[model samples]
Target: MRVKRYIVNALPEAVSMIRTDLGKDAVILETKEIKVGGFMGMFRKKRMEVIAAVESGASKQGGTELPQRKPSPEVNAVVEQILQTAQRSSAAAAVMEPPAQPDPPVSDKRMEREQFIINEIRDLREYMVKLSRQQSDLHALSEPMLALKERLQEQELDSEWIDKLIEALSESEKSADRVYDRVELWGEAKHMLEEWLQPYNNAEISRDARVVHFVGPTGVGKTTTIAKLAAEQTIKRGRNVGFITSDTYRIAAVDQLRTYANILNVPLEVVFSPMDLPKAYKGLSDRDLILMDTAGRNFRSELHVSEVISLLQSNEPNETVLVLSLTGKTADMAIIAERFSKYGIQKVLFTKLDETTVYGAIMNLILKYGLHPTYLASGQNVPDDIERFKAGKYVELLLGDAEHE
Candidate 1:
């Protein structure tokens, strides 16, 4: 048999090329896609690959004997790259191409208005195609993966992060050449989540930082979190603890910290401004650990965030932790985290875990803003309801028990 390879723009083009090169009797033995001609392995053009053959005697011109072949590692890599390029090119062409004009190009007042309408229609078409692709991708997942996706979406994870996870699972499916069962899918998700969060894991509160400041938006359980940490340091570790309240903005906040202080027999100092921080620190100088609680305001405002950051000024061995609530929306939390992150605050504490089941915000905050989570506060039962952040356990809670799914 005589074989010929033809690279063309499409199947019809390939058929035409084959008939002209190898005559009408040539049969299409194999057909696939490939890419060609690019600088530094990018900007390559997509083309169809056709392998055709004809009987040696029928051709009246012989060809080399055919041999069975399999892709080596390098060839496999090129194939994978070609598949990716083809997919991207196909999606872009489908989504971005404008409809063909019915008439020759012209410029006029009416045509200008018509062009604007056409552009708007084109944008709408792109949006609709985007929605259709999202729906199709979601539908492509099996029941287990679909359930996991729903769970993540319900937990308020960003769509970008969700797409990344689903894409990973889909790639795994391709690599294994089989669909993963529900348990396997869940397990894979859990493993991937744990792997991602592992680097930020076990970020416990420093026992050595004499001054630890807790800052957050209003009603995020900052004062309560302070009390919990104080209780842990004072009762569990048998270390001397003190409290300094810059939360003088609220009478209830002062009274609340005092109540905890009175119960724990820890000294409490109240500060009205950054000026008062010096006096407060002096009074708590003898204490092994001084936990400072800042007033939670509309930290969403950059002005308020700056006001809070100014109050956090401390010359001693100190670290600031940005406290966030699980009860809050991820977008708002992200804004708050972003505001705090700008001032070099990296450690985070989450509260109100018992109030919300959605935990994707934890991962989002950690990965998005590079905030290291130190503790998870669940309830009001001082020190008892809180625990240090562990990536493995958090992954279990975030993804649930994989096998049980």
Candidate 2:
């Protein structure tokens, strides 16, 4: 490679000089603006000093032997002078003396150029530091990430959910003073929470000639759950269970519940108005348990929700189970919980677990509101899919291990 330097009054001139000296094979290595000495350095001119190197293969004079190169004293002197000027400027700036003439404030253009260069240098330095930090972080995280990945795979967690779990783990790891210690702490907390969730399972309300109402939004398994509980009390427990449906809003829903009631050999009453709720309960008062099923109204519609809540309030069921679907978004679950919270939703019944692959949203809902889940329904089976709430089972399911007793 051939290296050379050019000093000219303008950048264009410097570029032209390098191009001419090294033909078209020149590669600019560095460029700097200088104040040329003219009239005792008072009348200064902008100059460009450029160093360029040319590749050997690209040289026009192919395999020709060249004479030994000699360094230019002028170039060496210029570099030395630049270094000395930098050192002197550093020393002078340290002393901090006021300038006599103030040297005329730098032009906006020059200031902008200098600022751009400074900004570029700062950005480059920051980028380099970030790259180094990321490298170290990746190296440190490799073992944990790998361990987590292996654990998740063995637990049969879907790959799509791995990123979310990893993110949660990473956040926990960062906030922890000691990662291993934090893991132990988190494990203990999880176990305690699981233990706390155990007693909440048998949410079965015992009523002797008392009206029990199940009310919530659409498709939350309100009708089916009413049938399930009604069947369990009537068939398994041998309680005189009577089913009442104000779900005359949907004839199909009424028919569905009536079918279940028929199978259980229980009396079924279909009511239309608020007045009908009391009348229906009175008709079934001869029975030991009266399970009233309400139509699934859209919770988002305030007017409809008010209507449902008004019905629930009028009936005043001993215990109201706010049926919430587990498959819904966490925000939607929260809104539903809040909406029904007014209706005195004492316990939460999460349904449709079999339909959803993710259960973290369930944990988020329960933890966010400190909700106590009354029961969990996994499938469409009346008395089979439904299981009492168990926090350990839920935590295991959430951690990608669904098979827990």
List, in order, the clash count of every candidate structure.
0, 0
Q: Which lDDT tens digits does candidate 2 get at residues 296-345?
A: 87776667778876666443436666788876766677787777776556
Show where candidate 1 strays beyond 4 Å. Answer: 1-115, 401-405
- Residue 10 in candidate 1 has what lDDT? 61
Q: Candidate 2 versus the native: TM-score?
A: 0.55
Clash number for model 1? 0
List the lowest-lDDT window of 10 residues for candidate 1. 61-70
257: Cα error in model 1, Å: 1.1
**For this target, which candidate reaches the highest TM-score against the unseen true structure?**
1
Give the Cα lDDT of each candidate.
0.78, 0.63
Question: What TM-score does each of the candidates earn?
Answer: 0.71, 0.55
The C-alpha RMSD of each candidate to the native structure, in angstroms, is 15.7, 16.3
